[model samples]
Target: MPSHETTPAESVWDYPRPPALQRDPRRIVVECAGQILADTTGALKIMETSHPPVFYVPPGDVRTDLLRASSHHTWCEWKGRADFWDILVGSDIRALAAWSYSDPRPPYEDLVGHFAFYAGRVDRCTVDGYTVRPQEGDFYGGWITPEVRGPFKGGTHTHGW
Candidate 1:
C-alpha cells in the first residue's frame, strides 16, 4: 500500500471550487523590506500551483515604479516571457523575488507588467495586517479579500509554517 505521506491530495483541477467560489477574488499587497511595491486591485482568487497563487493583478491598477527591470527572464508555457526584478527597499535588496510579464500572450495581455513576488523572501507581509503564513506550494503572502474564501489551503492548514 502507498504510504499516506506519499499519497498526494487530488489535483486542484479534480476538485474545483464552486462557480461562485471560483469567481471570488482576493486583493494582494506586496511589499519588500518595508515599502509597498504593488497594491493590486481586482485580483482574482489565489490558486495554489506548483509555485504559488501568483496574485493575478489587473495591469492598469499595479504600481510600476516599484519595479526595476533586471537581466532575469523565465519562460511560462501559458503566459510567455516572465521578466524578473530585484525588489529594493531603502538600500537593501532581495534578488529576483519579484517577476511579471511585459509582453504576454494575447489572452494574458491584461496582466502585463503586473508582477508577483515571493512572500517568504520579504521581511514583512500582511493582507490587511492579517499576517499571512507561507503556503505549501511557494513563497507567497496573501490577503483573502471579501470576494475570496473557503477551503483555502494556506490559511489554518499551514499555521505552523
Candidate 2:
C-alpha cells in the first residue's frame, strides 16, 4: 500500500483523469552539467490522477543551443505525438532528456513547442526551491514536488494503475 502522508496543499488522487493544464507562476529551474539549462516563472503544469504534475517551460526560456533533436518520438492519446531532444552540455550528453509536443491536440494545444525535461536525467529540477523527484517510469516525465502527495502510478507495481 502507498503511504498517504502528503502535505496539506494538494493530493494527487484528487487530480483529474484526462489531465488539465494550468499556468504555474512558481519559479521553475533546470540545471545540468554545471550549467543552467532552463529557468522560468511562466510554466504550464499538467495535473492528472495518480501522477505528479509535469511542468512545461517555454522554448524561449530554455538554452536551445544545448539541445539537439533526437530520432525519438512517442504518442500520447490526449496530447498527441512528442519529439525528443538530447541535451548536450559541453562534452556531456543526456539522450532523450527532454521532449516537446510540437502540435498538440485540442485543449492541450498550449503545450505545443514548449519543452519538458526529465528530472531523473538532469542534474537538478527545482520548483520554488523544492527539488523535484522524477516520476518512477522511464517513459513518464512528471515532476513530484513537496506540496503534492501521491500514491503515484509509474513504478514497477503500478502497471495496472
lDDT of each: 0.54, 0.92
- Writing each residue's lDDT as its tens digit, candidate 1 over 49-116 gives 32233465555655556556789788766667988877666588788777777797755666666656
Q: What's the TM-score of every candidate structure?
A: 0.61, 0.94
What does candidate 1 score in Cα RMSD to the true structure?
A: 9.9
Cα RMSD, model 2 = 4.1
Query: Evaluated with TM-score, which candidate comes out highest?
Result: 2
Candidate 2 clashes between residue pairs 3 or more apart in a chain or in different chains: none
- Candidate 1 residue pairs in clash (backbone atoms < 3 Å): 119-139
What lDDT tens digits, residue by residue, belong to model 2 across residues 27-101?
999999999999999999999998899999999999999999999999988899999999999899999999999
TM-score of 2: 0.94
User: What does the lDDT read for residue 72 in candidate 1?
Assistant: 76
For model 1, what is the C-alpha lDDT against the true structure? 0.54
